[model samples]
Target: MADDYIIRTEGLTKQFKGFVAVRDVTLNVRRGTIHALIGPNGAGKTTVFNLVTKFLEPSAGRIVYNGDDITGSKPADIALKGMVRSFQISAVFPHLSVLENVRIALQRPTGLSFRFWKPDSVLDGLNDKARTLLRDVGLEEFEPVMAGELPYGRKRALEIATTLALDPELMLLDEPMAGMGHEDISRVSALIKTVAKNRTVLMVEHNLNVVSDLSDTITVLQRGEILAEGTYDEVSANPDVREAYMGTGHD
Candidate 1:
């Protein structure tokens, strides 16, 4: 049963000048499921994410991934272990074409990341795989377009495509649907679902509807600690969750 969990944290805590940002939080992300973390502003969602991904060190805690204690691992180390985090903002080379951006991402796994001096033809071998990722994210039509020229929503889709190029086993998405209209949200939501079929996803999102639709499990945080966690229906019905998350008039 231990193998069922891809990542787990025990007594995770973080502090800044004696101010506790995350306190004794324990989380278990199951293998092959979409897990969501949601909370109000300053609820420490990002802090927890940083800690888990090893961008920030925990003051007290242990992070275990695939049965290994990775509490002391670096960000790149964790990434090499198949846990990769996509940034909250779109991260792609503006000057590059959409296909180029994904080709660069694919280079890392092929030992070509720092070989900038290599002829462009050396990267041509990566184009087919990059195009496949673009098609996977529904951006094949825009492959030749400048990444900066694409609309905002499409940029996010491009970002996802690049992340997928890394071949992450567990993808950590930070607000994958942060800024988008209804249509973009719908498209990206479906893409997330399709990509999740073979890999696990752990996302921090503010959109309750998106969370409700995609998450197999949800964890609610408040004041740097877990307030409630369960399926959407279970947490939505809790009186405390209603008061804290949905507010008094939300019913």
Candidate 2:
């Protein structure tokens, strides 16, 4: 069973100055599945992402990715191992053109030092790759536009394109829909589903509507612990999950 899982955690825990943020939580994410982590405020959803991405060291537990024990590895190292994350806020070069942001990200997997001597023509191949990624994310027409000049939704799409440049196997997205208008949300939501076709996606989402539509499975957390885990219908009808988020059909 473990062999079929792309990301597996055993008794994962994180603490800050003796305050436990994530408890002993064991999780299994099937390969090529869009597994969502949902919860009310302060449930440690992002903390788990930080721990898995190695942005934070766990107080205790083991993190296994692709059948290897990778507990406490550096973020760069984890990313090189085919795991990548996107921030809640847009992470792109504000001054650079939309295409340059993705071109720079494509440079990472090459392991080449940033050299002033490298001619622009040397990166022609990478720029082509970046162009493909931009098109994949629906930014082909905006490639020459300064990244910051694009609309917020397109900026988010650019960041997703940047992550795709890494060619990740497992992707962690933290609230990919935060602060978006309805049209922006729909666009990003469709982009997310397209990206997940070839990768395993584990996301922390507050939009229950997105969860219902995009998630292959859902894990509901409450007060730093898991309340329920199942399909949308299964977890939605769960007494504990409904009570924690909504009060006994009051809404």
Per-model TM-score versus the true fold: 0.96, 0.95
- For candidate 1, write residues 1-251 as lDDT tens digits: 88999999999999999999999999999999999998877889999999999999999989999999999999999899899889999998999899989999998899886466788898999989998999899999999999999998899899989889889999999998888888998988898999999999999975556778789998988889998899988877777767666563133
Whole-model lDDT, model 2: 0.87
Candidate 1 wrongly placed segments (more than 4 Å): 248-251
Return the clash pairs for model 1, or none.
none
Reference-based lDDT, residue 39, model 2: 85
Please give the CA lDDT of all the candidate structures.
0.89, 0.87
Tens-digit lDDT string for candidate 2 (1-251): 88889998889998898888899878899999999998877878888878888888888899999998999678888888999999999999999899878888888888755443677787777887888998899999999999989999999999999999989999899899889998999999899999999999999986566678889999887777778998988988888887787753223
The residue pairs in collision within model 2 are none
CA deviation > 4 Å runs, candidate 2? 115-119, 247-251
